[model samples]
Target: MKILHTSDWHLGRIFNQQSLLDDQAYILQEIIQQAVNHQVSAVIVAGDIYDRALPPADAVALLDRTLNTLIGEHNIPVIMISGNHDGAQRLGFGSSLLKHSGLHLFTSFDQLLEPVILSEAEGSDLVIWGIPYCDPEHVNQYYKVKTTDHQSAQEHVTQLLHEHIARHYPHSATHVVISHSFIAGASVSDSERSLSIGGAECVSADLFKDFHYTALGHLHQAQHRSYSHVRYSGSPLKYSFSEVNHNKGVSIVSFHADQSCNIEHVPLEPKRNVRIIEGELADLLAQGKKDPNNHDYVQVKLTNKEALLDPMASLREVYPNILDLVKVRNNEGSTNSERSRAQLARSEMDIINDFYHAMNNEHLTDEQRQILQNVLTELNNTDTERSSKRA
Candidate 1:
């Protein structure tokens, strides 16, 4: 049995205040195409199906269309769970009714023992257990078990699943665990929110050892943890500038009749990619003119020490989707803050003169300088008298 694993869709995500519905819609179409091309038995969406708990109308529409095409049109079964960003109750709305259409949503704790059985001519061959993003308090109240942190919560939850499986289906078969979590040792990028402060949120990869394949979410980078079968499919598109180099994709997992598994990564290309470009403003403009995909979202780093008129406005003329602009000075690549620190070392008069010129495009006249000096001397004398009185 073959299943395509993908997650972290983050529908309704806005990057730099621009909507990503078009980009998301484009990638989801490709994913559907891949599903058809690969002929996978089911599609597994680990979690983070929405960018926020309350999503916009268009985002909800996009999700509806995508699911309709996958489940209604193609007759593909989708196993989805809710992530930290999702409102579990909202996402799982109409889930029981939707299951008739082959959409299995596991959003609450009571559904942990339930399994989505992938059957063959003889009987069930694969048993999938989904553990959604849940709080320790909710788990404690549901199972009457105490869990202090995220790791402890996840450990206890998986332990119950193990016991339930052992008791009910002791037969030989391929068991799959689908969850949304931050597994220890998985590389993290800026886009993912820390589940907790310190290291309390991270769960050990050893917890999923008994399963044939563990499809995980939470991390926005496609990778495996501890073993090849345990994996994260990553977000379909780059959500932050830090993810410029991420090779975003989905994992196609195949489960054999013998209970063995094979995992393959199939890349998903976005309509417009996120990237960073560095150079002087003039050179970047020159380069942008020659580039065809200059429309890609970019963060510009200008190497010019000298000031320019509206660098962001200028860059937007060529690369219309510039994410942000940063100014760097000198051969050593000092930042804008470093330049300000250097200005801090200058005399007050010098700093004022520079600020005056920057604002008015003219330096202080000799008469203006003399007037400023007299005012400074008067202020110094007044400060001296006040300090004497205080002493």
Candidate 2:
């Protein structure tokens, strides 16, 4: 039995203030083409179906058309779950009816019990247990179990699933577990939103090793954890520069009677690939002249230290699709991680001072510093009026 696995669609995503809907639509169509090419039994999306809870109207329309083409036109069955980025109830609306059309959306908690059984006349049936993204507190209250963090919550679910299988379908079918989680040791990218605060988000990968195949999501870079059977299909499009080398694709897993599966990674070619290029402004401009794919989503890290006049305009002349123009730290030759760590160790005013120096090659005057400090203090005041917007 074989199935197509993909995840972290993150539809309607915006990167560096640029909307990626067009790129997303193109990649999704490629995934559908792959599904049809392989003639897979089912398509499994691990989660993060939408970029946000209340997605824009266009994103919703894209999803509708994509699903219609996949299920209505091509007659492919799809299995999906909700991620932390989704509004579970909203995503699962009309899901009961959609499942009849072969779209099984597992968003709510109680769905853990009702496995989607892909019955075969040959008896090599597939039993899928979909675990949607849930908060530890909600799992505790719903399951009547005390799970204080993500690890505990997942362990509880794993134990319950084991008991359920033992009581009902022990060794009867090939079990596949699909979950949206930040599993331990999985590589992460800036594109992923934090599932929980204080780094309490990761769960042990050991929990799903016994399953025939476990499909995972949340972390953008697709990879297997602990065992080959447990895998993440990754995102079809690169969502951030942190994932510049992700080799975006979907995995087609062929399951055998021995519970071993062969995975074929069918790469998704995007209309515009995300890329990062670093060099001095003049050198980059010279290189961009010879570069063929200048329309790709590009992030340029300038090695030049001094402030320049109209650098973006100069770069844009060569690379019109440039997204970010980063001013690298003065001659230290730092990696992104090093710069991030250094920023975290700095105070807000110090960070702003660095930016000021980069812009004007001067520090703030005493009076200017005092005024900025007052503004910062006022912003930090708990009594200060604040406006809220959905991120």
- TM-scores of the candidates are 0.86, 0.83
| Model 1 error, position 308 (Å) | 1.1
Candidate 1 per-residue lDDT, tens place, 253-364, comes to 9887677788999999889999899998778999999988999999998986544667788789899999888876564576768867886777768767866764575789
User: Residue 313 of model 2: what lDDT?
Assistant: 89
Q: Rate the local accuracy (lDDT) of all candidates.
A: 0.88, 0.88
Least well predicted 10-residue stretch by lDDT in candidate 1: 327-336
Model 2: weakest 10-residue lDDT segment is 382-391
Off by over 4 Å in 1: 122-124, 331-338, 341-391
Clashing pairs in 1: none
lDDT of 2 at 352: 77
Count the clashes in each prediction: 0, 0
